[model samples]
Target: MKTFIAVLTIFLLSLQCDRFQFGSNQTKDDQAGAVVTFLQGNIFITTQGKESKAKIGDVIRPGDRIITKLGRVDLQTYRGEVIRIKDNSDVLFRDIAGASRQNTDIHLWTGNLLVKSVKLKSGQNLSVTSPTMVAGVRGTVFSFELEKGSVPKVKVYEGAVSVAFKTSPKLIELNEGLSKENYTRLVKTLEENEVVLEPGEKLEVNPNLNELVYLINAKVATGALTGDELSGFVDFENGLSKVNAIVSPQEKAEVETLVSIPGETIQKQIDSQNADNTDVTTQTIEKEHSEKRIEALNRIASEAEKTGLDNEEEIHSHYSVLETIHKANGEVLSGAVVAQLGDIFIVHSTKGVFQLSVDDIEYVEYRNFKVKTRAKR
Candidate 1:
């Protein structure tokens, strides 16, 4: 009887050891990415049927769903890519770290997200999947914005990106000077749908029509279009051939006046005057013109913001100069303000979306008004 009891105890001990080993392996397999940083409002993470509030220095495992409400979260993957998820956005970590053989895959459900990748080693990859399109990238800086009813928009900043539609087998390049004809051809061609995007190019993918539309409207907002192009594209009488019910004649005039004064030219004139000790009368006149130009720009920005606010459901339809960050070293960066996390301001410039440290910023110029940083309490 004693011998039989001892043998049964040994068997039970062996089973316990096996269970311990299995639990250790399960924990290792469930490991995911981590939250490197975050700022303002509520950021929640739901994983494995459990929901919890996320904070800085928290570990985010694979299969985790991150939801941001009135805040932003910056997450870093094992491969050293930083993803900044903006306010009112939902993203799922479909694959991260050891979850998949591939590098990383993120799914953006709604709102905007900016991705900045470190130089990748050979065979490393990062892909962002949206409702309509999938962007495969390597060592690139880019942004993805999505709305419920409209299509998804992707903009590249530094590196090139290849975007493909979920339904179509083709991919399209969004390189510089992609002509309207080539764009149309790609839309029509099924096999040659893939496009590479260069810096400063933005494209929107329409899943419903299986079409890609280059946002030429961006050129209008940035004052890059010539008078003829503007008149042709936006003028009610001869351009779009359709009347713009939203833009009043006075507003059109204001836009024209603001674009007429080149910001670069004004800066150059001011520099030259200061260097040559120009007459006070000439300097004063130039300064007055610059001030007036700034005022006009502010008015336009305000009107655009107000319009967007009034039509919140159609906010994506209105493109406006969101804000300008002036660096202490005299560099001016402009674009839509994606988010402000602590002392860092993320701005989507023509080059790409950049994170500007508040410590390095002299001030922010929005709608022609100068705003200095507030002192920390």
Candidate 2:
């Protein structure tokens, strides 16, 4: 079977490049790339359609729907957060939902997604619904996805949701297994064996777990950073620190460096570069300063990728062909695609999303979602 071969490989080159440390809640490794975690399910990937039972390292992509044999697909973020996609459903992953920021956001166009967001000062969030409606989070576990049927429906199995009413001053709380009438119209909040949620606690749901949704161990965890996944990894890392106090010294140092003016040498250089030139007024100076700050931030992230696994190995399997298959042997790109089961891979040279038949793309990566952010402190 000329299946999607997920050949994993890693080759770190030594250089006198400027290095930085991992920020709080961020991973120090880049191996994880954009993809945090994935598993084999009844997946379909293609321009329009495809079917296969993906193995260990198959890359998954947007427009791809994964149907688990019995349950659903559980995708964990670096912050130990989870998005459980139920069986027999479809959720269109819109974007990477940036990983390295204070909050990681994943937009699910349609399908069932059980989200266990890792808390941070600016915690992570996963939105799994149409544009009209969205799920907000402030560090907690929850689930939302469209249930299959003649008419697609939205379901939230855990946590409370500030369900926006179609037309009224009424915003109700949709708890676990509490059928939210806003979207699904399957409105039903199981009152039996149910405990009232504390303040800041959203709806409680047990779509698959049955009546008792509170005991499902919805506590989300954090993971290390790896590969180009530094950005998202950083987000998770920071989130962890804020929620609790789980941070490495290296990360602490880096965070400190970001908040301050940084090294004197670079400071002097930047100062001189913009000094005295009245033409470089406050506006210009601030602009240049901001750019440098962002550069410093990228440096911090890049250096962090150099760190170890706490940074898992999910996003380190993509490759950049050397233009020609015969010639481009082992010549990968700066970024890689970590393969999932139904990843519609469009190699740099290929025109469309080609079927990556690599059984085990040992080294694969999915790009992290980009966000508008300040470079550094």
Q: How much is the lDDT of residue 305 in candidate 2?
A: 46
Model 2 alpha-carbon miss at residue 119, Å: 0.5
Go through the candidates in order and give the C-alpha RMSD of each one to the true structure.
Answer: 24.7, 24.2
Worst 10-residue lDDT window for candidate 2 reads 7-16
lDDT of 1: 0.53
Residue-wise lDDT of candidate 2 within 150-182, one digit each (tens)?
121232223443332111111121122222231
Cα lDDT tens digits for candidate 1, 223-313: 4544333222211111001111233323243222221223233333334433654354344434554465456544544444444343212
Cα misplacement distance, residue 231 of candidate 1 (Å): 36
What TM-score quantifies how close candidate 1 is to the native fold? 0.47
Q: Give the lDDT of residue 7 in candidate 1.
A: 41
Best by lDDT: 1
lDDT, each prediction: 0.53, 0.32
The lDDT of model 2 is 0.32
